[model samples]
Target: MTSVRVAGVGLTPFGDHGDRAGRDLFAEAAAAAIDDAEIDRAAVDQLAYGNFMGALAEQQGHQAPLMAEAAGLDCPATRYEEACASAGVAVKAAVEAIRAGTADLVVAGGMERMNCLDTGEATEALAIAADELYEVRAGMTFPSAYALMAQAYFDRFGGGRADLAHIAVKNHANAVPNEYAQYQREITVDDALDAPPVAEPLHLYDACPITDGASAVVLASEEYVTANDLDAPVEITGVGQGGDRLALQDRDAIAETPAATEAAEVAYADSGITAADIDVAEVHDCFTIAEAMALESLGIADSGEGIVAARDGKTTPDGDCPVNLSGGLKAKGHPVGATGGSQIAELTRLLRGDHPNSEHVADATTGVAHNAGGTVASAVVHVLEVAE
Candidate 1:
């Protein structure tokens, strides 16, 4: 019944680290988080590491213990994997552990060393996160899944490729001020339209990059926070998760993210806050179309109105209900397993008002972070409030 607060947040730059391995990056980010929290290594009772592709990429399967040993933190640790929602799942688990009085301090992190393989190999490895028997075996790539969703949106909403293009342009523009973003270069909607097609209706500019990165956070109970005098702590007011049918064919419509909507509904009820109370949000924008769908799922926009809202500058960094001020997965790079952790880290910075691009959102007392996994089959939503 107790509240959990973030004592510290840390992240390595989100980019392709040609020589770094996932374990190495995880250790670095974990150490940084421990230092930031000013908590002794021994105080960390548990370690929850989120990683989706270590086995396929490096044949490094046992990650939690390996990460703990590499970081020199002799604590019980476990690996969490819900595809790209891995880190967000870890966050929820860490909070639950604290609420259950099982641990006072824990380290939650995610790491992905992509770019170690060629595009084909990388895509094959990532496909393991999907429903292999039904989806991957049927030859459906992630982009194809999203492309179907984009077409559905257009067909149902009267918007087409142009709407998705606007999302790409807006998010890239938002990324320029974010030092950790993978794509900081601003692009015009015309540029997006002209880009090569990755999948039908989804151009190169609409997709997130294959990134390598790590992120970490120190989670502590509210009692522990006050006892330790943590600096600028932020309480996790709500945490909820929901799952949908694994195969895209099982869903009634491709455009609607049912899991995201269900998760957000649970989170809003638990936190006693409506979408209107959210000052800033970090939504999963793995694809341009995903961003628009997220807006609808979060109830921030009516169905099919997300693109219009975004194009009207409503989702701009300084605009009403700013979304993805951290550049989002689209421009910030999507390191699969590490993405959810990175999203929370960005929110931590926003909560502390320490993000370099401070003008993005003003006086954000409450914020939300949403992440989805496996073609929106699973989702995790959380609401954070500034520590009183």
Candidate 2:
């Protein structure tokens, strides 16, 4: 067995790229990551890429080989897609390959181009990630689905829109200094509350925007890192993936994400730590309610208690276990496939003391990244620790 080290991380700005092709975005991110790794480009043995809607957005179903060429790599490339968790699974596969001794170095990441599509086209494209027969045909957009979750939470757990707004405000504040973030301007709670309603309970401010971008990370085995003297300071100590009923109607509870809970538990066990050991987190916050759900799954908040954590000042930057210091998807931008890799990239920089938000978690030694697909029907969790 071998440890996986994140030798380098890179991300294109997480916002609209106008007419830039997906390949072009991925190429820039891959090049930046390879450059940051400071290793011979030829040493990279494989590429694990991810994209969710390339066929619809760019008419490219086979994105891995195209991206491999675009990134100027001469290695076998494989593509993984689990909707929003696409990059996460790709990274996990790259780690597994390194640990299995089948590869010494690998590049893992994802790219998404949503701004190119019209609003209706993009919504329809994203809806394909849901259950087509049950959810899509019934006209359940992500916002409406999350809104139902929020309503269910309020019905069962006793929180309201105000609580969720705090999460939006907190994440927006965190994004202000993040150069790659889409909406760096902070929003007040009132602003979030007053924003136009996308759904009953989820307002415009509560949801992540349609972003277009790419992110990449270079991974090396412990042996490769030592043999090459790579300056990698972040180690991926644990990885886990979990899945549940795909449709919300089939789930036991509409407000909870058991898949995320299962993934978090397994990842924590793999890392030889409990949830209490987590010092920071970057979670899937496609909607504000999702941040609460993720925190509960990670045990940062007790069941039914996550919704108020931000409002209560428990999950804020100065709190005991700060979360989403990169502003999260709520403000940092959610470029579908690229978001998972972006979370890991942001966490690596924060752990390495290079991110603008690092000061908030200066003493943090361990962190978690959680990504989910399709209302968290599928989820991936990874534990990262500063190298000893």
Q: Residue by residue across 1-388, what tens digits does model 1's lDDT show?
A: 8888888888888888898878888888888888888888888899988999988877899899998887778999999999999999998899899999999998997988889989988888888877888888888889888988888888888777787888888878878888888888899989999999998899999899999989999999988877888774688888889899988889886879999999999999988999999888999998988998899999888888986767877888767888888889989898888888888888988888888665666588899999999888999998998877
Best by lDDT: 2
Q: Cα lDDT of all candidates, in order?
A: 0.87, 0.94
Best by TM-score: 2
User: What is the clash count for each candidate, in the order shown?
Assistant: 0, 0
Pairs that clash in candidate 1? none
Model 2 agreement with the true structure over 185-282: per-residue lDDT tens digits: 99999999999999988999999999999999999999999999999999999999999999999999788999999999899889998988999999
lDDT of 2 at 264: 91
- Give the TM-scores of the predictions, in the order they appear: 0.97, 0.99
Report the alpha-carbon TM-score of model 1 versus the true structure: 0.97
